[model samples]
Target: MQIRDLPYADPGVADARSGPRFLLWLGRNQLGGQLKALAWGLLHFCGVAGLPLGVGRAVQAVVDRSGSALALAGALIILCGVAITLGDTMLHRTAVTNWITAAARVQQLLARKAAELGAALTRRVAAGEVVAVSTGDVEKIGWFVEALSRFAAAAITVVLVCVGLVLYVPELGVVVAVGVPVLALAVLPLLPRATRRADVQREKAGRATELASDTVAGLRVLRGIGGEELFLGRYRQASQEVRRAAVRSARMWALISAVQVLLPGLLLITVVWYGAGLAQDGRIEVGELVTVFSAVTLLMYPLRHFEEIAMAYSFSRPSAKRAARVLALRRTTEPSGVEYGRPSGDLYDPATGVLAPSGRFTAVVCGDPDAAGLLAERLGGHPAADPDGAASVLLGGVPLDELALDEARAAVLVQDKDPVLLSGTLQELLDVPSSGKVSAEDALKAAQCGDVLDALAQASVDTDGDGDGDPMRTRITERGRSLSGGQRQRLALARSLVTDPEVLVLDEPTSAVDSHTEARIAAGVKELRAGRTTVVFASSPLLLDRADRVVFVHDGDVAAVGVHRELLHGNAEYRAVVTRETEEEQLDGITAIGELAVLEEIEESA
Candidate 1:
């Protein structure tokens, strides 16, 4: 593909069965660019290889005292120079183009895969791994891809130069030929060790990156809980491990590089020493001696490409494997293209036996936070395995997995308990694909986000000139760390509300807010989402009391289902889960209050 056509309309399906296969697939896709680079490289190295011959002829012309021959030799040298200049320039251009194009294709494919998998991508792959693959791995994969064509050209040029030397002076040519191959192959024994070292370094680096990502993501929480030093120490240890691995890997590669340099130097010394002897014995001409020396010197340049190609492959192999692994992951909910226009029914998970009735507000009280999260994920078709037997989570009697992915997503929106607020302006965050019935302002109001907007505006003022006081234009820090947990929650809630999906499953949406604000938010949500299917997984009395029905989930199944008050009074488990106060504690607290009141009355009477 042309450079201008970069970011292919489709990067095409990758052969991600293995790292090597994925690399080959990338090579095949960029065949046109590779061919162009190969052609230019051939021209370039061929020019470079011809230089010694031209110089040899000039030396011979001088010794023979032939002016005509000397002029011819001069012309030949100039011709070779022209080819070298032109070919080298174009070769570099094409090589860089190939590198950039390959990198772009990988990035695009990654983006597409991320979009396809959505939240499931992180669940399957570590966040740090994903980051490393997209950033560092892309460049490594591209480096090998571009190196291939150049390496091929260099190899062919070496062969041609060797053949030319052999034909010119069979004795010296044979020696040079044999020595060159030895020099090239000597580094092979060291490659496996070097590759191993590199892989270890990469693995360690990935762990460090994951640790850093996790640490940064939870820095606010860590500070709140006064666990900053603990995480910081862990990250420091990880970083040190990465550094030590890198040093070890660097030492191994340095040894390989030294071998490559030292061996080639030895070969060059042998050629010069032997050729000088041959000239002295009158077995070869003095000019031929110069030719052999110059040719060997020039050959050293292309020989470096061999070492480079090895290094590139060593680094990129693991990178390609990581990329392949990520791309190989498939979504559990495979879209079947089943045309179920605007799914309208209860969101049911047969696995958990939890159901949120259509067009009703349902509250789920799961005692286990982990179980609640899994249930929320299942509700949104983000499970590793499709809930079979009934096919998957059914919406309106139609399995969510059976529907188109986009259709399913549009119909059901699940906001996890710890919702992420991506870095963007307030307006951009709320610019979701919505039903359009609720405006951003209305969504914000319904989510009780006035304080968040004000905080954003105040932040804007602190950063910029008196800041237009427009929260919509305020720049949020990455992951919305600039805001408090409560503010981030409110903003995320507003964003979700703007979508107005048919079925909205929210897990502890108001957990971070105070009781008064939570009560108002409960009312706001009830009023705004009236007549829509909304399932909130929370045990807050204010939120639960507002639900039309409450479903108490215990041991991954619906243990009891009724209004919040009825369940709270009738089901001891449900009451304990919600209130966290046993009947004995309640009686003791009441008795203590009555005794205090009696003492106060007697004292006043006395």
Candidate 2:
């Protein structure tokens, strides 16, 4: 089956079952491929089991008659060789197919779940855990899945070979039958301990991965603050801990391996010693004795599979649990009876007593940045305010939580100050998914991205690849690293404009740009979003001036709601804050001018 045809849809089932149950579920789902693999595996094992019997028969035939029986035995031996080679080849091919297909299915399922959850996924599970599960856990799961059929085939072959020996040579068969189980079961007692150690190793690895991801993501900030050394030291400590855990895990596995080898060797010795006595009593022929010994030797190969299966399970169980935990995270609770149709008008957050009436440009001006952030979250249904309480965000009187996920998401779009830029080209970056039908050119014009387009054009001219004339087709590095901070911010704003949701909630959108650029953006935004509901959370006077209405948020509540001019004129506290900010800017300007004057004087004196 194709990987695309695998069951990737989120099943919405909690993974609260035991490891064995989960494995069983996987087997049951991939039953077709699994059964085929098992059949081939059985055929392969039967061929292997037939080899010793053929050899023993050939030896006995040579001892009896010299011509015809020898020829028949020779033919049997040649057929056994051909069968074994063919069976081994088919077995390996089928087993590998099963492994790859199972891994692909799990990966598809995880990807679908990630899409379903969106931003809510990280809120539920750590980024590191998700990374681990997708990369490491999926592979281990496939290993165990593929190993299952081989394990079954090996076991069945051992049992059947032992039974056949009992029928053909009863004295040696009893010894072989009894010895195999002891070897397989001896490792059982070590499994629980090994599994526990494996769990610890996985946990440590996850923690180390999380620390490394965080450190790398924040490396620039840490370096700027001269804390790189400290973070590096911490990472070194974490790496050491992982090393220690790994050592412990390795030690357990080594001990299990040693026991696996020692027990099988002991079983072989016991069988040989007991069989020799039966042979002396003339109860078994020399050829029969050789066949029993060869069968035991062949049985050793399958017994090793028992060890391998045990080890694979021990390693894979924790990974499966982690994947299960990630899949179990619910994206949203079931919607109530409050049917959410198209929003009528306006967005209101009853919690902060803030409302942005529909089809109007609203600006939220908060004195405290933290309060502004919280207000933005509330407005966009991010924190998802309590339903029973009076602190709910509503779109056209429908509670945000009560609305279906698609409806709620389509109704409002929250653009943060530092927006994430996924790896793609400039055109793909601007073409984010949204219900509102807005063109890329229109959004670009609204964001005043002439300079951005120019930069892309310059890059395209310098680039030595085909189709380089299209500036929009230029590949952007992950998180738009090729772009400057202000450029990235503006590009993000343009993308949001392209979405053009009913309510566009932006938090400090132009905080990274120059005043001239900020002014142009403010004017362009006002003109582009003329008849839509756009809320800008900023204390910038340039943006505040263009808003149709500005709400003064103080101490987590709306202090006043009016035009910028009205607020500036009336509210003394608001006036004091704005006046202080303007004074600081003027003071900074004067200091810069003073420095320039001193430099001019020095040049004149020289």
Candidate 3:
């Protein structure tokens, strides 16, 4: 396939059995590109090998004073040059095409897996590793696949060159043949050590890359906490470690390169020394000596390809393994049957024994946020990891995981606490691919995003003071960094509401907002989702009071289920978790009042 028409309809199931298997799979995937590259590579090497024969014939013709033979040899040499030019150009083009296509295929596969796994992908693989695989690892894999054709062509040429020399002059040919193999094989012993060094360098580089990525992602937070210098120092140390590892790796590879060059040069010198002795004994012709010498000199070029191929394999093996790991991961839920599931009754999690009734707001109070996140994911039928043999969440007596992915997604929308707001216009962020049941205005109102809309409108480019600004036109910075925490949260809520799923699972949706804003949002959510199944995981009294029922999740299981008032009065565990937050707010209020009184006294003294 062409580069422009990339992102194959089916990237095809990867052969993740091993690193070598994965590299072979990538090669097989781009067979057409590889074949084209191979053909050109063969042509190029043929031109390279054919040159020595033509030069020998021309020299003999000159020595014999045969004008006709000289013209023929000159024509052959020119033809080889032309072939070399065309072959080299086309070979490079095809090789690059193979590289591009192979990389694209891997990227498509990784993207598909990312979509399937969502936030789980990052959890399963470190964010740095994923980043490295997608970028550097992908390129390395493509490089190896592309290099295979050239490596093959070079190897074949070396064999052919040695065979031709044997046919032309057996005495010299035997020595050349035996010596060439020795030169090639001698460097093989040092390769394992070099590869080990390379692996160490790669590992350090990946860690450094991950650290840099994390530091950049949390740059805003670092600045707020005045910890930029601390992170920078950490990164500096990481960068230095990577540098030292790279230097060690380079030194080993340099030694390998030195050996490869020195051995081949020694072989060339030995062949010339022996061939000169043969010529002196009248055993071989002058033309034959020239041809053998030129062939040995040219042979050095192809031998270098062997060194490159080894290096390529060493680097790409780890990369392919990482890519394969990502490709092999299966979504936690396996499709059970053909039928799509829609819960007509209560949404039940058998493991936790929590029932979120249909057509009502249910607030889940999980003592641990991690546990709550896991439960929320399970409820949505998209658990990040394996659910420990627990039965799939059931809705209306239908297994959630049994439904088609689309159907399951349509049925439940779980908004995690750390929701990302993609960089785009406000309209684009809300324009999610889903059933368009909820209007933008309705969702914004329900999300209590009036203040958010105003702030966005003020930041919008088209703020002409006409008083009827379209907040949708506002451009959100990456992850909505330009907006406050509460604004970003509200915007995320609005986007979720726009989807209007069957069961809306919100985890700490209004955590960043003030108590008053949280209360308004709590009421607005209840109003907007009047007859829909809404599950809110929270500990705030404002949100819990509005819930139709409150399920207290303590120590990993459902401990109590009742209305907000009943739970507050009856369950002490529930009361403490909820009231403790409120008590802190009251204490903050008292502190503020006392500070204001002190300021008033200071003003009176002045």
Candidate 4:
């Protein structure tokens, strides 16, 4: 039952089974890698059923003149060519190691259901259907679990070559045991119309891969609103409705491959027209009617593996029911096993009169950037509110959904103001999840980032200089797109102040820098986060004047709290919402005559 013990199994009895009973509960939880790839696919289908019993014993040793029957038909055609090349190389190395261990156990059960729905798996799935169920529904559930060991070694080599042609020649084994079960149950009534056209071509290829991953994650806000040819003509009409549902699921798999080649060429012309009238009525003998017409032409090669295990279980049962509805999303409140000990120091909320208290540097100041993104998802346990109601939030005396997702992500760390700068080195994006606990020159000197490490050491010595390096060790593109939005918000607030997280939070984190690099990042984040538990959010009056506490909020609650000049001399709606001072007095009355001709050229050049 490995694959890390199937994520603690009983996700409520895997939500009442189905998708072929969750592939028979993943072949009864990988029954020893499907019984060692079904015993090397029944010793590679008994070496392809000894190649039609060595071509009907080399055509019954050339109609038996019997002089050691052509050296026993050249030693049964060199032992049927060394048992068809050792059963086609152990049936393609045990069916490609049962399709790479059933696609590495459905990609380790969709990465343990995306680490048990962390960040609530993109609010319940559709990040292009979890990137098309982690890549084409994990290769169509490892091509129907390695085509169930070559469909149980092609149904035991079509019942041992129709019981050895019904004991040599019973009317050509009753026309090959009644025409190999009518050409393997004639594509089982066209497999429920080719599995409902391959589940409408896998739901129009997961809605054309969720409209091309939402038009490439909103191609830079749809090309800054030109709406990039209206989202590239709605992703070219969802890729022509996924190319007309993949040409109606390839016209029902080309009419099930033209009835698997016209029912095995009409059962090899009814076993050579009734075994040529029982070999001219001698009651079968021309070497047992050429060994019952070469065992009905080797029962059409295991009835074409019963039409390829009915087209790999009609395209892996809708890609294992879209990976079992993304491992049945959960989290509505569970982690109560305690252990969120350290926080005891301030970040209360109770709907609005926010608190923030702990080690200091609080800020908030909202004015509705969606109520500061729902108060940074209720101060980062990411969603589970209700700490005794009234807008609820709290941290000191614990409650961010009773902690535990690794102790509420190791005591809070939000960051987010378009943070996500993933793909690689600026020292591996400030060595995320704390590898080398924050170095890169103390997170680029608390993120003032010495001119982004001298412009990545002059673009890595103009793209390659033999100099032994330290171009901040190169690589950063992705969300860092080679730098700037104030160097990706001061390298994501210097990788969250190199995870000194006891409770960092942030949100605005110098919303795109400037005001003298947001007053040297509010005094280098109050001197490299002095006594921890930060918060910040920001309406940037230079990070709310280095906040010891600010609050403000509004319609969603906490209309005012303290310091930023005591809420600009006692909160007149927090000084008309953080001194947009009447839009800077209507932009100083439309630049008052170009500010008095730039004050008469600074008093006639002084």
Better lDDT candidate (1, 4)? 1
Top lDDT: which candidate number?
Answer: 1
Off by over 4 Å in 2: 4-22, 66-83, 337-339, 366-378, 383-392, 434-437, 465-468, 569-606
Off by over 4 Å in 4: 2-33, 36-108, 111-113, 116-126, 131-139, 150-152, 155-204, 208-243, 259-263, 281-306, 313-358, 364-408, 415-501, 504-532, 538-563, 566-606
Q: What is the per-residue lDDT of model 4 for residues 394-482, given as tens digits with 9 covering 90 to 100?
A: 78867766666777777777777777787766877776675345465776676787888888777877777774457667777777787
Whole-model Cα lDDT of every candidate shown, in order? 0.87, 0.78, 0.85, 0.71
lDDT tens per residue, model 2, 1-606: 544555545433434365666666777777877777778777777877887787777777776756776677678778877877877887788788778887877787788778656555665687877888899888998999999888988889888998998998888888878878888888788889888988898888888888887788788999899999998898899889989988998898899889878877887787788888887888777678778888888888888889889888888888788877776665344557576586757888887788898888899988887667657766776542223354558888877767676777788888876798998888888777865567888888778788888898888778755545676888788998998998889989999999878889999999999766787788888888888899999876667767899988787678999987677666755654544435564544543344335434543542
lDDT of 3 by residue, 1-606 (tens): 777787788999899888889999988888888778888988898898888888988998888899998899899899999989999999999888888888998999899888777777888888888898999999999999989988888888889888988988899899899988887888898899988988888888889888888888789899999999999999999999999998998898899889988988898899899989998898987778888988888888888889999999999988898899888888667777777545566798988888999998999998888888888888888766436778788889888777877778888888999999999988999888655878889999988899888887776635565545668877789989899999999999999988888899999999999866887788888898888899999987778878999999998789999987777666667766776635564544443344335434543542
> How many backbone clashes are present in model 1?
0
Ranking by lDDT: 1, 3, 2, 4
Query: Global lDDT for candidate 3?
Result: 0.85
> Which residue pairs show collisions in model 4?
345-358, 352-558, 425-428
Off by over 4 Å in 1: 2-6, 224-233, 281-283, 385-391, 457-468, 586-606
TM-score of 4: 0.40
Worst 10 residues of 3 by lDDT: 590-599
**Residue 246 CA displacement from its true place in model 4, Å:** 4.0
